[model samples]
Target: MSAGSHTNEIPRHRVLAKVEGPLKPGYETILTPDALLFLADLERRFGRARRNMLEYRQDRQERFDYGELPDFLPETAHIRNAMWEVAPIPPALRDRRVEITGPVDRKMMINALNSGAKMFMADFEDANSPSWANIIEGQINMYDFARDQLSYTDTARGKDYKLNDEIATMLVRPRGWHLEEAHITVDGRPMSASLCDFGLHIFHNGKILAEKGIGPFYYLPKLESHKEARLWNDVFNFAQTFIG
Candidate 1:
């Protein structure tokens, strides 16, 4: 079937591996048929490059263990020497004097977003334990937040939480290149956790954030080389085109 053909079911043209763990209720809300197809398309488009880069990382690690030091790539010296600066910062991110980050649990999500800080990164990597429940629930929290409907009720504390009218500008940090989401798979291989985190969040929130005059901003982690950065940039470019 064509990519757009399977709207409410898994696409037959792709070979998706079975999820390896128990899927909790409400997971279907985030891992819908269309979302899976989007992920499958990403894997088909970029999986080989991702695998090759991972292999390169392993080879580099072996060489490092054998006492080979690293150096600049002679091939890209001109690009490196060229003068450059990033585009102007987005309006919401301009006053980045204070920023906070934490995992995407209910309490943390409420606190971090409501914190007086200028920005809050809903971390899906270092601060997160990467359990299946955590990943899917994080996505849900982000989806709700984008729509200005996220809230938390703390019966234990006899308190309720809701977003402040003026809260921190939100950002997301996906899992590193080294991690794989064991719970999600495509083509009989574990899906790239980075892709899963980045894709799901962006698919759900990009347009909404854009409409709000903010961003679906991202904080990428554990990039060991310029190549990895380039890979992320490519993904960002593709995502912009795809989302648009």
Candidate 2:
């Protein structure tokens, strides 16, 4: 839907993603039929809630602009004060003394993965330009990275690049819920950029990474409230069950 469009009028049916941009060479592997369908499923399931949350964010910002101050919600104080422990840190992420982050371009991915840092975060959010070429190619680069098949050659400099033997553990940072992937639409509405980035990565590489003893990890960005965080947690749960 365009800005200010009616959200409730949208129909729920067979979910599909129509590519609105040029499908370049080597993109078919990343934008595979199955992958697109998986993305559609994600959008169909959670896209509306994401948009609602974004609306709430805007409304909250407007309130702040009108001199409203923030405060902790008393309604959830019980949970906050309750003693709880987070899940144990996975072995691959335990020693993160040095973590490097970079955009998802081929050269950058190869360089960062080999940068000797304990963790390398491939950022698809603010660090990346959301051009059609960049978005699609980023998926391809990550797909290859997970499978240990990524390589690049600088034809100008005649320099070949490849992953080092002792490379950093990889994590992905998807775009926040506020953004839309305008290049792909489902039910005549653009899919969430967050879903596009996270869905594609998890669809293509989640199983592969799980087999490697470290499940797919992510650095979620720009969450406004716990509701948004819960949305992500729900997405994670749904994707896990769907993929399994």
Candidate 3:
């Protein structure tokens, strides 16, 4: 016998239920088909929040912001201005135009920068062991050079630009996904051998730079097309939103 009705028949109605997680950190909502049905139930029981979801989104992002991410993503906004001179990278700078190799020292770089060559490439591919230490060192060395003393800097960059100056553009062709025999040794022993995606490194580092109110420098090489540029832009945008 039924409790509500003294009949063997059942009523034709949809059964619904809602479940909430225990109040704690790291609780994620399971949004299965069943979970959606439960959401409908919750709408019936507790009702929805008054604020429009989009309005709350930005606020939520702000709350989630650790203030560690950069404030602006870097992008080359080509605006034709009379005061500033515009020059496309020399044709020689394009992929396959210049050959690069070996562990480079500051003197060699200074020579390249001083040379009147339209393009100078610092190769991470053939040159030097691409261990993390080397990468960091290369970056520091690349970044520390006095641009004003360098030809590219004197012409494109201001005369005052010095080593460690946040001005001037430099091109670095980082070692690709080629694994070497000698792995990047960290802490003492060799930690691991792997490919370093310099593209990603440049993107994140560029943002780190931009967040510090500095302009990023670097000519991207071996690009297939606009895709790499778009990736760069996206990384920059993401970096800008958080790097504070």
Candidate 4:
């Protein structure tokens, strides 16, 4: 085999057992117990499924994979650091893959982490009371988990973290610059509900992640074209230099 090539088949692990949750209104149950058993047997004929992160690493190396993306910034790979103080990500993300879900602030975050997802963005900007205090508190709760996994420190903005036991693939979505009105109160009171999962996870290189030396955020909606992406990247890069 040539370098970076392997012919051996990797071991497979079945998710195994039956797990069920409630069906939402109007949705039909597609598989019965007998059907599930049959499907398992049918899968046995093929093989177990093993996830391989290296597959993704290989694609990234070959320039064969990326998110819904476009052209990259100059010296994109030559990036000195993730440089949240400089920028979180570039237009490269438009060419890479992006996954979206609500900010998991409560212990529900623990469930999402255990479910095998690769990344989590605890949402303060768009998932909690839009009050600055609430946003800061929710972020603290997330750092409760972060502190166990990595060494992080930033007391100025009241952000510090360390990590342990699956620190969680995570990012954070701040209130979208355009959509803060979606949750921010007019009288400056906390929102009756809270921010929904609508904003992108934009980090201005807070004292938390700056302590850890890692940075990235999921670009949320309103990003309609590459020019817009370039603009967002520039904004993040500029913001992170001081905050990050």
Candidate 5:
């Protein structure tokens, strides 16, 4: 479907099961119909490959368990020897001397962004509890942060919090491939937590972040091999094209 046509009227054929849980207030802001459509599309396009890659990981683990040693891929010797450099770093990420990371929560996010660090990575992986509430609320926190509308007030502590005028560049780290988001399912199977996290964030914030001259910056985690990284690159390219 055309990007412009992805509205609240997501085609029934594309709908996954409605996210299962007591979705908290403001959850609707991030879990809109169009956003879910975007996620469904991602699952359709890449889900099989994700599953296969996970299986390959298991196979490798079995081989290692049998005492087979691991080494660099002979197939990529040319790539190893070739001179190359990644794309130029985005302006906002160039001076990342100090980067703070933490799980997503309003007060912590506010502090992390305002910390004098050059970058703040809001983690949905190891640092986070993967409860359904945490997963969905993390997305909500990111949405508000991207729009400069994130703040927290601790009435009992008599403290108020808001972003500093010059806040750190925000980056996101999705959950690893080994994890599944039980709360969101596609075609009756658990959704890849990595894709769910990545898709929702990018679909909701990609353009807005671009307009702010920052980015859809990401910190990929728990990749076991070059193949996994390649898969992620493909996912990123497809999402970029879809959004455009």
Candidate 6:
């Protein structure tokens, strides 16, 4: 990447963002200027640490492949010995006995939201195709889902899909920290898929969902270390401060 990679293509008034993938019709709604700015902000704030974390994962994997056995780290003995308590579970999340999960396809998301499970996990990582259209349209679906106005028409089957009167609590599962969202780039580097997933949904719908008693719940997958988890915690804190 060149020093002027981002500046060369992006307008001065807008955040430095390069859309490498095809932006189909209506994708602009989800990839708005404000939302891309939010993503770029996240990338600027934590992108380096995220890259380091991925590099650490690779190093650990290589060591394991070379016959290095797993053992407790002496440096983290205090953490292992310390007695710690987690924050109290929120009332809305106390009873997550069952959660149904699927890709973030429009109709599938509607069906998952209306499923009888206690929670619906709209997965963007494992269960998704990760095509540009799938990812962007999924964001659109999430925005509408949070607003409780998500609907889909099966024109061929002549059927419509919508949320039920009583629906499950919703949770988003972003792509792992290891993944890169190749569609959009900040500073000529592809944005972290994790940030892209969490940033877009939270930037667009965090407050909307909060007003409905759900505080932008998420299920982070494939975290390998405390530092990786710490990165997410920092992202959450920064996002709250950014969007407050």
Give the winner by lDDT: 2
By lDDT, rank the candidates, best first.
2, 6, 5, 1, 4, 3
Q: Per-prediction count of colliding residue pairs?
A: 0, 1, 13, 27, 0, 0
In candidate 6, which residue ranges exceed 4 Å CA deviation?
1-14
Least accurate 10 contiguous residues by lDDT in model 4: 192-201
User: Cα lDDT of all candidates, in order?
Assistant: 0.85, 0.90, 0.39, 0.39, 0.88, 0.89
The estimated TM-scores of all candidates read 0.89, 0.91, 0.34, 0.38, 0.90, 0.90
> On a 0 to 100 scale, what is the lDDT of residue 43 in model 5?
78
Better of 1 and 2 by TM-score: 2
Q: Candidate 2 overall Cα lDDT vs. reference?
A: 0.90
lDDT of 5 by residue, 67-175 (tens): 9999988899998999999898789988989989999977999999888999999999888888888888889988987788888899999999998898899889999
Q: Is candidate 5 or candidate 6 better by lDDT?
A: 6
Per-residue lDDT for 1-244 in model 3, tens only?
A: 5577675443322332222323222112122334323323322322212123223545545765856443332453453322586577444334343343334355566555445444456666556665445554454454444223332345555543223322223456654221321322222222111112232233335554444433344434443334344544553454344333
Off by over 4 Å in 4: 1-100, 124-134, 143-146, 149-164, 181-216
Q: How do all the candidates rank in terms of TM-score, highest first?
A: 2, 5, 6, 1, 4, 3
lDDT of 3 at 131: 49
How do the residues 1-244 of candidate 4 rate in per-residue lDDT, one tens digit apiece?
A: 7899876653332222132333333112222333233223322321111112223334544664444444566766656456546445434233224344455454455555454445555665545556534544354445444344324455687764433354345556645433432222222222211122211112212445445643444434433334445544554454444233
Higher-scoring candidate on TM-score, 4 or 6? 6
Candidate 4 has a TM-score of: 0.38
Looking at model 6, the pairs that clash are none
